[model samples]
Target: MMESQQEPKVTIPPLIPLEYSNRMMLKTILECGDDQIGLFGKTVVVGGWVKSSKEVKREPVAAALKPPTAAEAFPPSPGRKELSCVEVVQSRIPFFKKIIRVFGVSSDSYPGVREKFEPVPKPPPPPPSKFFLQISDASSISSLMVVIDSAVVPVSAGHVLPTGTCILAQGVLEKSSSHGKQTIELKVEKILHIGTVEPDTYPLSRKRLPLDSLRDYPHIRPRTTTVASITRICDTLDFAAHTFLHNHGFLHVQVPIITTIDSEGFSEKFQVTTSKKWGLGSGSDADVRHETVKAEQHIEARDKSKLGTGVKPEVKEDFFGRQSYLSVSGRLHLESYACALGNVYSFGPRFRAEKTGSIKQVAEMWVVEVEIAFSQLEDSMKCAEDCFKFLCKWILDHCPHDMKFVTKRIDKTIVHRLEYMMSISYERISYREAVDILRKVTDKTFETKLRWGVPLTAEHLSYLADDHYKRPVIIYDYPKAVKPFYVRLNDDGKTVAAFDMVVPKMGTVITGSQSEERLDMLSARMKEFDLSRDQYEWYQDLRKHGTVKHSGFRLGFDLMVLLMTTGLTDVRDVVPFPRTHGKANN
Candidate 1:
């Protein structure tokens, strides 16, 4: 079920007594451990893939004449002679059972002082011939041994229960007194095999798989512990993002994925087109140029015609009648809703036609773009800080178990990093001040020289956040020439009111700025970019009517998850179905 995207159909027991009905309570391995003490004499069910299995032969013994003491039990007295007792030889088979406990001990005097239970015995375990299963339910894993007779589940000598076979078992919880120690374990009565895998053919067996190897089988990789744990954390991140916005009175607005405008003015976007039946497929640049020139000549000829008649000139119809592309950002469209709704946010897929395959870049990724009316650059920075902090705290409180896996295997300092980020306020620095700090640093050589007007690279960003600041740093008031034309120009006319939030390890998780609200300023800026005037008339109208100072920032939702997860360095590994240059796999 974890390997597939479809939700599993769950069956729950009706309200009834544990002993009265045949139905068994479905419990997770973690839940089973919590109720270990109280679950005695109760019938419950658990499902997981079998880790190991073995067959055991049972021998019959006659009625005991007297009871045996503790020392004379299974690990019989070292030097004691064997008892001569009659044995009724009958054929029977036994299964394995072992105990697992999930709990902690505490004292009332010191409320915070706590202790864990003693570790399970490491010496001799149950006989090797019994069935054993290391079961995982994507939350916690446990070792489950079948303690049933062969009569319950008939098996031949040649029959084998291979690893990675999914199964559901109905059992009663009980304490086990085996060769030397006592432990709690399940005693299975009936079992059903949901699916079986051939040990020789299964790609993901019990062996530890490398992260890169898992990428080759994305469809089934979620069934593995690492991927499954990451998927769970991603779900929490998605919920936390929306919850933070909703709490701040931000309305969730759905924006179009297909748009006619390149919102960021980057010109890097995926073109959307229907089946090319009208000479639209596979054309060279020269051919496209020739066709464009022909279309222009036809329009010019029609315009030159003296239309003394009342009928308007006929126009050719085509798909959309204009070049449209997948949206690079929803910030432009979001402004429309923001102006009417006060504050609005869009969370969905955004595409880019970039060919680079850097760890931080992906062709298709999700972004959380926000827009706020009647606000300025400062307000955008404050809102970004508040929303980001909320998400960090939410994950720490909600997904501790999954986080433990990340902290243990990936970056050991992830928890501390997040805690520090949540504990202190984000420091703000002007772009010029940031450059000055970099210039003063003589210790490390920067690939890109420190300069006032140049755009900051990842190296510069990491140094500012991780090496110098030792925390998230917000650098604002970037040079106007290097920033988007829509960013509000300062009174000095040299720098624009733009900001970027950079954190240690992950550079620039959020980027935004106050937008130009003056009609003349916006028009002049658009012209500087060489964009067609008619294409932006709608955007310009907002300023002509009643535009107020507005600002907002966009956060790469998957990139944020990568930062929170610590050692996960690549955005491709974090996002499901990664779309990269020359690669788009389902």
Candidate 2:
């Protein structure tokens, strides 16, 4: 009865363990060291881009006195014991796996046998028996050496692997016979995948491409050592920031990317427009008529308003109603959440349209905006400092491999600078004190003409961090008139309780301030700054209903990455798709 029962219709497919399902990273085997004798004879599938390849020619099987004979090709079928070298060679075998030995009568390999017959033409030195390839997957600076035999996977003599040719192959790791080469190498038995490259047009074919030149080929530049290393470092920094914020009991609130209020007050911003742009994409006659009617209606309404408008239209035609823009900062929206929810933070993209040509400046950037309720300037500074330190330590601990790679190639002092920041306490000084140091310096001349009310330039901040203090310097108490309207005015009434943290090689990375919690004072400041009361009435409501002293900071994410990588001078180098003035070549 049991034998008559039918088996289940569905059969489970063979399960592949995660570690073996995909090709092993070169880093895994490389970290095992040059001599991985313990791992020898183990089979692994690995993939990487071809960094270089060379064909090694060996000594021909026959001696110099006579050429290889046709009889050496093999013994007659009747008496043949095994395939001879001549036969294997003629069979297009690139490697001699075993010694040729025949039991039956065969042509003598000895010179005397050749003397018994007319000499035959010696085949030009046999095609290189082995192709040596060095490939890297950008996992590490060290590349894995792969040995391929044409006998196992036949390739023509002219076949060459150009740089950037990606390949995946299954092979066995074994001890290398070469004296000075890597102690262990992959002996490829089968090639699973191959992405050949055209040497003529492959952009990254050179051994070392300048960082500037890499901008032209952003799509493929991650294969480069410096760019790849920087990319990994940036990735770690991003995660570290989130982890640090989460560990500290801070709530991450994603603010609107598009907003009506200009968070930075006077900074230029990208106007957010509806995607229904006219005259860009082709459309049917009905679609055109629909768009034309909408435009006509808007123009007619504007014309009607110009002459005799009694009441305003309920909602504007813009995407968000009225004017909207890509947010320059998330602080304003995030502050609302902090006031209601205690400690809150936001980290995301921010767009700026200032026409400055500084290397570190980009049209689009990332910022970590933090707002702490009932906190003062001191608390804000401490929170930012801790966050920065935690991020540096995180990268140092989790990204040692990438750090070492960048240190060796880009900036040698980067590691020490990071260690310094982690161990030593940051230096804190008032804006007045920083100005005194700048004026006292006779070595470098000032470009802005040093003044108490003027905003500090990159040169000034760099001088304080890189040269004078030789560490991170937090400058606080800037002139209230020059700062944003929200920064709390100090007791003196002339300066606001604002601060900026400047680091060596990376000028001002963090900006923090104690926000004005008093409704009366905030409204006055906003009015004095010529801000429209109607536009910022909602912001004022935070103070009117229930306001507590709130402090926060905006840390430039790209600048933090630049700080971690000592070699990079520009934010563009760290950002994968840098959007700058007139250039966004993705």
Q: Which digits, one per residue and each the tens of the lDDT, describe model 1 over residues 58-109?
A: 5444444454432333344468765322111111111111111112322344
Give the alpha carbon lDDT tens digit for every residue of 531-554 in model 2: 888888899999988889999999
Candidate 1 to native Cα RMSD, angstroms: 20.2
Model 1 CA deviation exceeding 4 Å by range: 1-34, 50-129, 139-150, 155-160, 174-186, 277-318
Best by lDDT: 2
TM accuracy, model 2: 0.80
